[model samples]
Target: MSKTDVSKKALLSVNDLCMYFDSAGRRIKAAEHVSFEINEGEVFGLVGESGSGKSSIGKCIIGLNRATSGSISFHGTELTGIKSRREYTEKMRDIQMIFQDPMSSLNPKKQVGQIIRDALKIQHIGKDAKERDKMAADAFRRVGIPVEYADRYPRSFSGGQRQRIGIARALAGKPKLVIADECIAALDASVQAQIVNMINEIKKETGTAFLFISHDLSMVRFLSDRIGVLHLGYLLETGTAEEIFREPMHPYTRKLLGAIPRCQCRILLRAANHSVRLSATTLR
Candidate 1:
């Protein structure tokens, strides 16, 4: 199904998700009462300034850090305080994460093919060794990586290529939801656009839901079906990408838009218009 025709079936849901940390005997609130829902086969963009806890929320979803208090569910299974390993693993198999730093996210010692294939092996995607190899090569090919490069090390690849590998690793699981945390931030603008386009194509082919976390509003606008604006660890506003870009309700959102004075109006207009053909569903 296309994004515009996405069903209202909630693939992931978060309510009152609070992630706090104690630093030097002081409570640091990273995310408080942040809530949003990602519909089936839709892109739910989360945007914020640096330290706005955009990645923190993504981490919460992937279980890198536990929620201090809140609810996170995947396909109706509650993830908060989850005690069953098998349950979490099963749900996680339907979920995968692509970290921002491709170089760091991958294992330095493992070959690129091994890295991608490991995801399938862990999930047992293939019934036999030959099938698994074919699946791994297919993933590499889909991500624009040559199957021959599978045995190469990540350190030998360029930044953009490494990012592609990271994406391939994430998709190897054939997950229902993929949390991409600033997956293109480190690359140049041109490469960034390429990755975004690649992601869009993959989404269309796979019908996967994306919780796309990024600091760049333009990028978010280009990919998101719905958007939630975060500030100082609090979700200030949420609306259709067009609504938020064309007319920002919160002062923070406006401030963020206005920060790019040179291309302020241009960015907002393009982003707003980009959403014209996108789905209308937004988090309430």
Candidate 2:
């Protein structure tokens, strides 16, 4: 597809999407007037602190949580109030989710092979058990998981391995868009880089769009083509990663950047604080 074709073809379109909950006598707005478009083959980063409604937006897009108002259209179809199982399944196939924790996402009782095959079985993609098994093994290999490990339980593997299994499962159906909610947060720093690189590679190879939600600004900058900042359930800013990073316009965006640790500056800040405290004690 040409650049214009890819830009115009949004895998997911969300407009004015709002989600609220009744907590005691007060109302909590988890997502307020959130609007964005995720184009084909683009990785969009949703950066926010906890309670900023980043994950809530992902849940609403995937149909795990209901929206109170606004619209979510996947491709050209509206997804609100989709109750039919067939319709839901079709929508889900187009948009898959990779959650933060891989261990919890997989079934403890089911073998790794069975878990990967479940989506294909449910979608009735393969004609027979042999075809399904072959497809599952291929998916596992694509995500860097050894085919032999498919028979083992999730507990048998390390965090990175389990995450690869999760990615394999998510791609088994060849979804157009994947919502990765803090998907790399649980892994070690080194493993996090590997997983992020793997995700970028897959996106480039398959032309899959990704909505990567995380609080890690640096990582998001590395992975995202575009970035959206959220604060207190509202979207503060949206722009290309370079624009947002080099010339942040929103106050919240500035604060979020300030919170990130700079090696030399952070040490200097700590030393200055310590000196100020000592001075105060002497004066008192």
Q: Ten residues in a row with the worst lDDT in model 1?
A: 275-284
lDDT of 1 at 275: 42
Give the number of the best model, judged by lDDT.
Answer: 2
- The models' CA-based lDDT, in order, is 0.85, 0.86
RMSD of 2: 5.4
RMSD value for candidate 1: 6.5
Question: TM-score for every candidate vs. truth?
Answer: 0.88, 0.90
How well is each residue in 141-198 modelled by candidate 1, as lDDT tens digits? 9999989899999899988999999988888768899999999999998999999999
Tens digit of per-residue lDDT, candidate 2, span 196-222: 999999999999999999989889999
What TM-score does candidate 1 reach?
0.88
lDDT of candidate 2? 0.86
